[model samples]
Structures are given as C-alpha cells and as structure tokens.
Target: MSRSPSFSRPPPKQFNTRRPQPVAEVLKRTDAFAALRAGVEQIAALEKDLRQLLPDYLGSGVEPGFIKDGVLALFAAHNALAARLRHLEPRLLSDLQQRGWAVNALRIRVRPQAVKEPPPVKQARMTPVGADALHALSESLAPSPLQAALARMAARHLRNREPKK
Candidate 1:
C-alpha cells in the first residue's frame, strides 16, 4: 500500500496596525516624481509667456510646435524672414532659458515663395562695311612694282573718265 504525500503548514499572517497611505502622500514621498511635476508646471508657464512674447508678424494665428528634445520649431513666410529669425536665434534662446524654458535650440523653416526673374539687357547694333571699300584698300596696298603699276592704271582710268570741261 502507498502512503499519501504530506504538506508543510503555511506561515501565519500578521495584521497591520496602521492605515494605508493616500496616493498624494505616496507621490510626495518620491522625490523624482515631485521634481517632474514641478518641471512640467514651469514649462507650461514659460510656454504661455513665450506665446505672448512672439511678434505678430510671425503669424499670431498658428501655434508654435515644441519638441521634447528642447528644439523649438517656427514657420516663416519666406527665406528672408527665416534668415532674420535665425540671426536672432541666440538672443531668443537665451531669453527662453532665462525664463526657465530649458530650450536647447530654435529652428526656423521658410515656406515656398514666388521667385522673380531679372530684366534682360539690351545690346548695341554693329554697322556693316561695303565690299567696294575692302577692294579699294587691298589694291592700294599692293607690293612696290605692282603698287606703281596699279597707281598708273588708276590715274589713266580717272583721266579718261574726266568730263570735257
């Protein structure tokens, strides 16, 4: 005949004399959570102040997007405005940091704009020379003996063509 397996007796439970702590009390006991809450509250206040401080020309209607990595993204109508904002970024970031925003950087993006083409330049016209002028110059410049013969021939031709006056 097989014997039944024996089990060990369980330990006795102790009753708590004190009441359970409240959720608020528990959260307060954790320093990390408290610091996180304070940081979030400060960030909210800083965001509100920043919204009011931004210029109206930067588009008062749209809200600026804030990144968790401490980068602030803003949109500009064109490259000129974006460049202007980039120039002032250092000061803007410093101001935000002073207000406890903890911003690491600011980025401005330009929206597409129509580009204008420059006007065309006008050029001067070139004058044309006659072939008769070129031939006369060539005949006058013929070498020594040839030059003399051409000159005599030209003189005779001119004499024959003269009027009987």
Candidate 2:
C-alpha cells in the first residue's frame, strides 16, 4: 500500500492577513525610539526659544542647526550675520537659560546659502562623424547576428540625423 501521488506534495505556505500597526504604536515598544523622540522634541523646544528671543539679540539672522553635549550650533548665511551672531552670543545664552534650555555654550558658523540654479542641461546626441564611422563599421563587418545588430543601430543613427518630413 502507498499514498496517492498528489498527497506526496508539500502544503502551500500560509501568510498573515492582519493590517500593519501605526508608527507611534510601533515606537512605543522600543526604548531607543522613545529616547530619540524625546531628544528631538527637546531640540525643537530649544529652537522655538531661539526664534522667540532672536529679535533682542541679532534680529532673525541666525538659525539653530545642531546640538551636541552642552553646545548648540547656529548657522548664519553670511560673514556679517555670523559676526553679529557672535556679538549676541552672551545675551542669546542668557535668554536660552531663562527659557529652561540646557544649552551652556554656542557655536556660530557661517553657512552661506548659495542661490540655487538648475544645472545647465546638456542635450547630447551622436555627432555626424561618429554616425558615419558606425555606418562604415557596419558595412565592413561580415554577415552575422552581431553585424545585423550594428547595421540596425547605424540605420537608427542615420535616421536621427535626417530632417523631419
């Protein structure tokens, strides 16, 4: 006695059909995720404090970039703006402390914002000399699949050069 031929085949694998959970729900399960989220929220609060006190220091010439240890880095778009920010550092630090920020030191760096311009588009195509060379090569090759392919390519390149009817 033997099993049927169809019974010998392995069963199809099963897949879960449940919907995916939201990112916040997923993050709740991770300790590192919670800590990172808290750090980001703290930075945003510090940024808000800087924005609010900017006028009293150097107008809005400075922007918060990054924070490490007790130092908060600020970016100024020009040398003049950076110099002004340097002069306003003490007052800025004091204002930040008053707002409950733990920032103890400031680093002002000039980050000139370049005027963004679209890259010059280069419209490139096969030059007439190149096309002629390809045509000559195609003609010189012996009949084969490769020769046929080269012939088709040369024909396309020649057609590209012709003015539209």
Candidate 3:
C-alpha cells in the first residue's frame, strides 16, 4: 500500500543558553593575540595622527607604519606618492615631534596598490512605449530583413512584459 505524506511541524531548534563574548574581550583574554591587538591599535592611533598632519590630497595615498628608534616609516601606494612623501619628510617629522610623537625622521616606502576595476554599467531596459513604437515602425516597413529584425526585437520586449501564470 502507498503511504500518505506527513505535513506536521518539525521540532523546535535548541540554542545555547550562555551569552556570547565580544571579540575585544576574547582577544584580551588571549596572551599572544592581546599583544598583536595592542600593536594594531597603536598603529591605528599613529595613522590617525598622521592623517591629521598630512594635507587632504596626500593623506589618502599614504599610511603610517611602525616606528623604530625614533624613525617612523611611511608607506605610499605609488612611486610618485612616495616621492611626494619624501619631499615633505622634514615638515612631517617636525610636525610629529611638535605633536609629542617622538619621531626624529621619516622613511617613505613604495608599496604598489592593487588596481580595482569599476562596476559594469547596467543596460537600459525597453519600455512598453518604446516597444510599441518599434512594433508600429516594423508594421510600416516593407517586408525585408530589417523589418523582420525590428519586429523580433519588439515582440521579445512585449513578450517579456506579459504576466506569467
């Protein structure tokens, strides 16, 4: 004998009773990760200060790196940006010193940035008015390949507008 299909509701899902811990808290609980996190935060703070000191146009292409023995490293996205950074090194060093950063010198490094392609442009959709116009034009034209092509285009667009059952 054939059996009938059952449509009863499934059992309830069981979730954990304990509350989730925040990422920062978890990182702080670990030894190695805590040190790494501290270093990353320090760099972020330095970058913020550097951004404030730099001109608006130059700030975006340059980033602050680690400071070693009173020398601060600056990474640039391109060679031209690196050259510009080098030209402004003395001013940047003096500004950083005035800000109590303990920076005595600036070293600029060229790090090529990855090129990103822009998003593809969307194709314009065919409106019912345009499709109707094409249909009328196709009707007015003589029986030729061009007329057939126009009729096909109009039909395709009009058919797309029809509601499906």
Candidate 4:
C-alpha cells in the first residue's frame, strides 16, 4: 500500500547567492537613511548654534564628532577650554538633553592645531671691567679701624720676614 504523489516529481534546488546592489541606489529608497541624514544635519545645526551662543563656555572654536549612546564628543582648542567645558558639563548635558539631543554626557577634548610662537628673548648686557673700576671697588672695600689694625699687624709681620728693601 503506497501513497500517490501530489504534484512535484523532484525536490527544489537551493542556491546560496546574493545579487549585489549599489549602496547609493539602496540608500536612495530607504526612509531610515533619510532620517539618519536629517538627524546628522540637525545635530550639526545644534552644534553651530551652541558655538555661537556659548563662545566663552564652549570655547572659541568647537568641532563635534560622533554622538553615540547619548554621549557627544567635542574637540576644543586647548586643555583650558576643555577644562572649562568639563567644569560646566552637568549644566551643558542637561541643556542639550532638554533640547531632545539625547546628550547624556558631554566630553570635551583638546585638538592639536598650529603652534604658537614663543616670546621674544631678552638680551643681557655685559659690561667690561677696567683698572679704574678695580680701584673704585678696592676703595669701597677699605677696612674699618679694627680690620685696618689687624691688616697692619699682618703687613708688619710679612715685612719683618722679607729681605730689606
């Protein structure tokens, strides 16, 4: 006793292959891609606005990098500016989060740019000493009465040991 076949005479073949499609063509029709572009533009605009409104606190110049997991990384000019921004991190994070930016944290880092010129070097003057200058110094260093008495005794002792002049 055998059952009769319904329709197919053989099993279907399976092919593991993917037809390559241009990325630009695929993105053109994606709503999610469009939303991503819009979000990027919005973030850029917000960053620009922040730069204009909070120049002192944010820094003279700021470059916004990737935003991930509600955190935004920004590049400042120097450590001083970064430190200032970090000091106000809580307020800045709150403000940005309030603006629906999903900014849970604000991290500021220093960006390397051009090196500044060092301050001018000061030249020191070197005065030459002459015999007259030495004489003036010797006069200024002349001994007091007690010192002169001691020096006279030393001179007398030395002269006594010397051959007659």
Runs of candidate 4 exceeding 4 Å displacement: 1-36, 115-165
For model 4, the run of ten residues with the poorest summed lDDT: 124-133
lDDT of 2 at 58: 52
| By lDDT: ranked, best first | 3, 2, 4, 1
**Candidate scoring better on TM-score of 1 and 2:** 2
Question: Which of candidates 1 and 2 reaches a greater lDDT?
Answer: 2
Comparing 2 and 3 on lDDT, the stronger one: 3
Q: Write the per-residue lDDT of candidate 1 for residues 1-165, one digit (tens) a residue.
A: 436444544433432336675545555656878966565555556557656666766433323455558887766667777777777788778887887676898877766545668777855322223333333554869467776665565555555545789
For candidate 1, report its TM-score. 0.35
lDDT of candidate 3 vs native?
0.85
Collision pairs in model 4:
none
lDDT of each structure?
A: 0.61, 0.78, 0.85, 0.65
The predicted structure with the larger lDDT, 1 or 3, is 3
lDDT of residue 126 for candidate 3: 98
Residue pairs in collision within model 2: none
Which clashing pairs does model 3 show?
none
TM-score of each: 0.35, 0.46, 0.58, 0.44
Among these predicted structures, which one has the highest lDDT? 3
